[model samples]
Target: MSSLVQIKDVTKTFHRGSEDVPVLSGLNLTVAKGEFLALMGPSGSGKSTLLNLIGGLDRPTKGSVSIGDDRVDQLSERALAAWRARHVGFVFQFYNLMPVLTALRNVELPLLLTHLNKAQRREHAETALKVVGLSHRLKHYPRTLSGGEQQRVGIARAIVTDPTILLCDEPTGDLDRKSGDEILTLLQTLNQEQGKTIIMVTHDPHASARATRTVHLDKGQLSTAQPE
Candidate 1:
């Protein structure tokens, strides 16, 4: 498979008063198409930072992040947003769904940025909800759904755009063991059946075990960049 995501000597730093604290330094890693990668670390380990960089939500203070042939770190804000819209899907610990919108409408939100018509966008959203087995709950609000259902809606929203790279931050952090397992299995199916390149951050070893590869990050540095 092709190399879908690449991190070359990537480093991130933040300024606290007069001193610059570094979280990542000279990190190099590559994730291939259809690969499921788990990022593990304790608090302040830079796992979430790495996921943000991959998703183009933040730039590395130094170094480069390349998605396919494009150097994401180098893109301008506007360009990066456009690139992300086309290539990246994001799932977070929180559902981040609009409280007023029904599940179907919430999933349809991402598609609004596209040029697709309302009908076309609805079709896409419905298909995505169906994929997560939520078609029957289309009219339900976030408060009406279970934790798993909400997360599934989040997943459906993320992939409704048909992105090549799916970046999930603490994907199962808010769910019970059974719910988390179900979410993990669903992600596994996405990688195996749909060939979406997934990079996920989690503290759970069992969750990490479900991935094709696991990367450990410590103090923002990739302690283990290669697959395990």
Candidate 2:
């Protein structure tokens, strides 16, 4: 597997009034194509920061972030937005579905940015929902679904566009143990069967255990010993 995502000597800092708070310090990492990577860390350890940088949701204060041949840190805001829509798919802890949209409609949101027409988008969304085993719930709203179902909907939405990589942040954080386990199984299937490169930030040991590789972060740096 070749490298698909690369981070080099990256640093991220935020300013709170007069204080400079650093999140990631001179970090370096690489993710291979079709690899499922779990990032684990305590609060304030820069796990989410690193994920955001890789997903192009945030930029590094210094150094480079490269996905494929594109230098992410160098893209203009407009270019980055366009790039993210095509190359990245995001699944948040909260299953960020719109209350008013049905499962199919929610999954079709990303397709609207592309040239696909309404009928084409609906077809694509239906296929994605079916892949997540939610074909029966296509007409249902988020409020009507269980936590696991909602997260499944979220996963469908994330994969509807067939992104280059999937970035998940605490995907099972808000679900119960059984629900979390189901979601983890779904993620594992997505990686193993569907060949999606995944970078996930998770605090649960069980969740991290499902990944191909688990790396720990503390005080803005990666631990030398990664668990496989």
Candidate 3:
């Protein structure tokens, strides 16, 4: 498969008061098209930072990041936002759904930015919720759903835009074992069946085991590992 993501000698640093704290240094990696990759590391290993950079939520202080044909690291804030909205989908540990909106409306939020009419948006949102197996809960509010259902709603919203890649940060972190397994299974299905390139940050070895490959980050440096 062709490369979907490429990172070359990337580096990122943050300011902590007067100190310059480096998070990632000389990071280099590539994700093949439709690949499922799990990023593993202890706390402060820069796993989240790397995900942010790949998702175009933040820029690297040095080096380059390319997703498909676009130079991700080079885009300005406004341009990156637009690029991300079109190409990248993000899932977090917590389901960040709007409380006031039903699950269907929450999933439709991304489509609102597009020129699609209300019916089209509703159709797309329905399909996405079905993908995540939340079709029956479309009218339910976030507060009324279980942890897994809420996360599924989040996944639905992420996929509703039909992004080129899906970026997940501890996607199963907030769930019980059963729920986590379900989420992992859904993510794996997206990678294997839907052809969505998936990159996820995970600390659970079992969760990492579900990935096609695992990459380890330690103290701002990265090393590749085969998922066992």
RMSD of candidates 1 onward, in order? 1.9, 1.5, 1.5
lDDT of 2 by residue, 48-159 (tens): 9999999888999999999999999999999999999999999999999999999999999999999999999999999999999999999999999999999999999999
lDDT against the true structure, each candidate: 0.91, 0.95, 0.94
- After superposition, which runs of candidate 3 have C-alpha atoms over 4 Å from their true positions? 225-228
Cand. 2 TM to true fold? 0.98
Q: Candidate 1 overall Cα lDDT vs. reference?
A: 0.91
Which window of 10 residues has the lowest lDDT sum in candidate 3? 219-228
Ranking by TM-score: 2, 3, 1
- Predicted structure 2: lDDT: 0.95
Model 1, residue pairs in steric clash: 23-220
Q: Please list all clashing residue pairs in model 2, or write none if there are none.
A: none
| TM-score of each prediction | 0.96, 0.98, 0.97
Specify the poorest-scoring 10-residue window by lDDT in model 1: 219-228
- Clashes in candidate 2: how many? 0
Could you give candidate 3's per-residue lDDT for residues 90-197 as a string of tens digits?
999998999999999999999988899999999999999999999899999999999999999999999999999999999999999999999999999999999999
Tens digits of per-residue lDDT for model 1, 36-154 = 99999888988888898988999999899999999999899999999999999899898788999999999998898899999999999999999888999999999999999999999
